[model samples]
Target: MLDNPQLTQTVEQLTAVIRLTVPVSEISHVMGPAIAEIMAAIANQGVDIIGPCFSYHYKRPSEIFDFEVGFPISRAITSIGRVKNSNLPVVKVARTIYHGGYDGLAKAWGEFCAWIETKSLNPQESLWECYLVGPESGPDASKWQTELNRPLND
Candidate 1:
């Protein structure tokens, strides 16, 4: 289950990502290679990653999801291969943490959306999820944690 949502400000982030429009079912398949490539490219460029990976969704899920899978960098770097450089705007957001496996993310998102509706908040189309702990941390899905952030209109 997710905790109650809270409004917070996030720092602007410099990231390296591979953008794609993929069906929800194929997100894992697409993201896996993209993440590997981006991470490897960043390493090759001698760039340091400052945070866990994230997925920035540009549109709500339907038959397809328009998103970018990437990592935050310590400094801006040149793009390499399919890995392009981008920035996440520093803005006010509704935040919530999901403590579970990826399978439970949809439920968490639904609950967060309901909370937003109840508060009469205007959410932007874009949202991002930071993977605080995941496979790299361990095989225990129950121990994973992800932070979801939805930008709110001023």
Candidate 2:
């Protein structure tokens, strides 16, 4: 019964957040390491309500993203302070909800981007991430609710 939920593109003013991240052009190879580092840190520090975090790229100089990975902050994100201090504008984003585990996240991302194309949306060069929901709240990916966001039609 689970299928793609309707998506919406809107402007958002997110609250301040802290995170530690490394940029790797190869998303697939790097995703495992990123999750591992965050999980390891969570194991030691305990998860906190750090809010949603995203990585972005843009087609233009304006603040916008083409794709994003959403992760609910489970630990204190003190590492992102340096970035926020830069006073940068966040990429404009489009959001959709999905039901499944993170293993299929890449596929979900592909679908989202495809949807963007069909809907006449233009992807920015900037990538973005969103924390629609967390698997921690559910036992399995089938029961997980994830929110995927992409920067488009800006």
Candidate 3:
């Protein structure tokens, strides 16, 4: 489900975001509005999105997890409602590209984490996924591309 797993550095990004802590079952419901609100705010402010949308997970999965859905912006801007300015730190990560629907993401993450363990890599709880291609691109779930990034311990 994932390809070319490797250790890599994520470029630091300035973003506009909306953050929340939600159960695994509620992620889709929460993220959809949060993403739309962020995007609309950015558009209203006339800022250009510098990169794809990212969902940063601040805790390992359990009954609930902290997550932020946002887009990289060219420059920091004023906060709008729940949308706020944030920064993505430059960090080493175990990264891989998953080509499938979002539903299979847990399997991809499991495989990536196993790969990290095999390499004896120490990982942090924080992780992020960049959606490269999504529903906006097409309806084919098989073609959706997501970059899964697990941060490494410093």
Candidate 4:
């Protein structure tokens, strides 16, 4: 489900994001459109996208998902429509790459959290997933990779 998890640190990054607090069932319906709107705004401002699309969840999800979808940018950008300037702050994290389709994410995260527990690591409530390779990359779901990151508390 995922590669060997590793402890690592992330560099802070600037981004243009669209914040959404939607029901779990509504996530798929909103993801595409939110990403497109953010991309269009970034393109209009001529901001260089430095990373793939990612979702930064503000808390552990249950009936609702409060998160921001966006891409890391080279520099700051002005707010446009639903898109606004935001950032991924530097933090210590437990990171791994989930090798499968999106439907397998929950299982992957479950397995990952188990590993963290085994290692006695303290994890924060927030988490993020970077869509490294997905539907746009190819037709084979097995080849898709999603980078899962769970920030750790010191």
lDDT of each: 0.90, 0.49, 0.90, 0.95
**How well is each residue in 1-154 modelled by candidate 4, as lDDT tens digits?**
7999999999999999999999999999999999999999999999899999999999977899999999999998989789999999899999999999999998999999899999999999999999999999898999999999999999
- Measured by lDDT, the strongest candidate is 4
Model 1: per-residue Cα lDDT at residue 76: 70
Q: What is the C-alpha RMSD of each candidate to the true structure, in Å?
A: 0.9, 6.8, 1.0, 0.6
| Residue 85, candidate 1: C-alpha displacement in angstroms | 0.5
Model 3 misplacement above 4 A = none
**In order, how many clashes per candidate?**
0, 20, 0, 0
- Candidate 3, run of 10 with poorest lDDT: 59-68
**Model 1 per-residue lDDT at 82:** 83
Candidate 2: where is the Cα deviation over 4 Å?
Answer: 1-92
Candidate 3 vs candidate 4, TM-score winner: 4
For model 4, the superposed segments whose C-alpha errors exceed 4 Å read: none
Consecutive 10-residue window with the lowest summed lDDT within model 2: 79-88
Best by TM-score: 4
TM-score of 3: 0.96
